[model samples]
Target: MVVRQTVLVCVLAVLAYVGLWALFSGDETETPAAPDAMFLTDYSKATTGSCVKFNGPGENDLGLTVVDCKGSRAALKIGTVLPNTSGECPRGDYKVLRDTRHNAALCLLPNAEPGDCFEIDTEDIQRSVVSKFDCAAPRVNVQVVDVAKESCPEEAELGVPYEDLTLCLRRVR
Candidate 1:
């Protein structure tokens, strides 16, 4: 009977030690959760009677027609004025406006008219534009989307026609 009790005690002690080790050693190997989806907004300048063109990182150019232009926004669609693209923007199927000299483009919903422009903060736009335009490299004309009125505050002073705009972009995941 004593031997049996001794053996049972040893087994219980070993189990307790294991449980304590597991509780204290922090052996959890689970990865941290990824961030939630985010949207970045930006604005584009439209030329009168000229369709705004957007080129994807893969060298596909998309054209968006300007139905009506207000102070800073224009209503556009894919079939109404935008030309068919061999390959469309990876973001979605809609018309987006881009600068003639810039690689960054604004993701606008179909038929987005002036004053109907959705508001987006600055950081999101920067991340989205950098991801979409591949601005990580050096290029003669680095395309940058303006999300804040103050982002390019000096553009007006320098005689550049930059405008305040917004965009919505999700995380790549």
Candidate 2:
């Protein structure tokens, strides 16, 4: 199933690239026009499980770069949030990374197992096309733990974070 999804994503990526290429002229320096309303969705408003570039933490107008999970720079995937957010992120793990004043929640891709540290890249990141190659590289390791109903299991260690609902975690040094 994963293989099929990977293949599908690859095919879709190729198609999207071809479409984008056709949208541009021969000038490599020419910037593509801003996306139309039909294509204005950003990472903050993307669907759950959608892979997105981890552009450090901020709530500025600099929109996120959404991409295929198979692609690189997919440091995080969108997670659940409170309802009625008007497409903005809610109070959650992603909100912490993004700090205050923004609505977004994300978890390290692949839902790290208990006591496991996930590696991610956090340097020289900016708005750009993120590729699968980026996922092959990482800069730091952080631990993740899944929480339920805002509470950890009795056996789970203490932490002070939350993501959507079933997940609150602390980054292990």
Candidate 3:
């Protein structure tokens, strides 16, 4: 009987040690923090004429240039943002779809897809007014241009641009 009790005690002690080590040693993997939200601004509100331009932080300290005008939609050669790796699958990892527009291009990634709803991060939206315009002034009718993918050669194509790629901007009261 004593031998049985001694063996049981030993087993229990070992289990306890393992439990304590797991709790204190931080053996569990720590989760990564979520990437910050991104935002968009209305091109109309920033510029007076038909065209509006903006830039942002991207991969390799390179920036992205967005040009929106009456009938033209082009994305200039800007830097890429570091791909998000916080989740099991990273967001923002993208491939260029094509290059045809002057200083403009298209890209494709899982995060940016058609029908994927995302909240805009107002704080991330930065602006430089190349031309000043009053918000209340007559708003120009701008049509977002959809570049043709066929113009790009098969090898140069990245992926189809999201159908709804327009930056949805809301006016602040």
lDDT of 3 at 53: 25
Global CA lDDT computed for model 1? 0.34
Relative to the true structure, candidate 1 has a C-alpha RMSD (angstroms) of 16.7
**How far off is model 3, as Cα RMSD?**
16.5
How big is the positional error of residue 154 in model 3, measured in Å on the Cα after superposition?
34
Tell me the tens digit of each residue's lDDT in model 3 across 22-117.
Answer: 888955777876433212232112211122123443322233333433222221222232222221212222233222223333322212112222
Candidate 3, overall lDDT?
0.31
Look at candidate 2 and give me any clashing residue pairs.
71-132, 72-131, 72-132, 72-135, 89-103, 89-104
Query: What Cα-based lDDT does every candidate model obtain?
Result: 0.34, 0.45, 0.31
Candidate 1 at residue 33, lDDT? 73
lDDT of 2 by residue, 1-173 (tens): 99999999999999999999988847667787754222213324556665555444533434565655554345445555323334444443343223223454333233333444444322211222222222223533344455466677654444434344544345334
Per-candidate TM equals 0.24, 0.36, 0.23
Per-residue CA lDDT of model 1 for 1-173, tens digit only, reads 99999999999999999999988997569887743321112223332233232333321434333332332222222222222223344333334444334435443432232113232222332222221223232321222223233333333211112223332222211
Residue 19 displacement (Å), model 1 = 0.8
Q: What's the C-alpha lDDT at position 69 in model 1?
A: 30
All candidates in order of lDDT, best leading: 2, 1, 3
- Best by the lDDT measure: 2
Report the CA-based lDDT of candidate 2 relative to the real structure. Answer: 0.45
Each model's total of backbone clashes: 7, 6, 7
lDDT of 2 at 113: 39
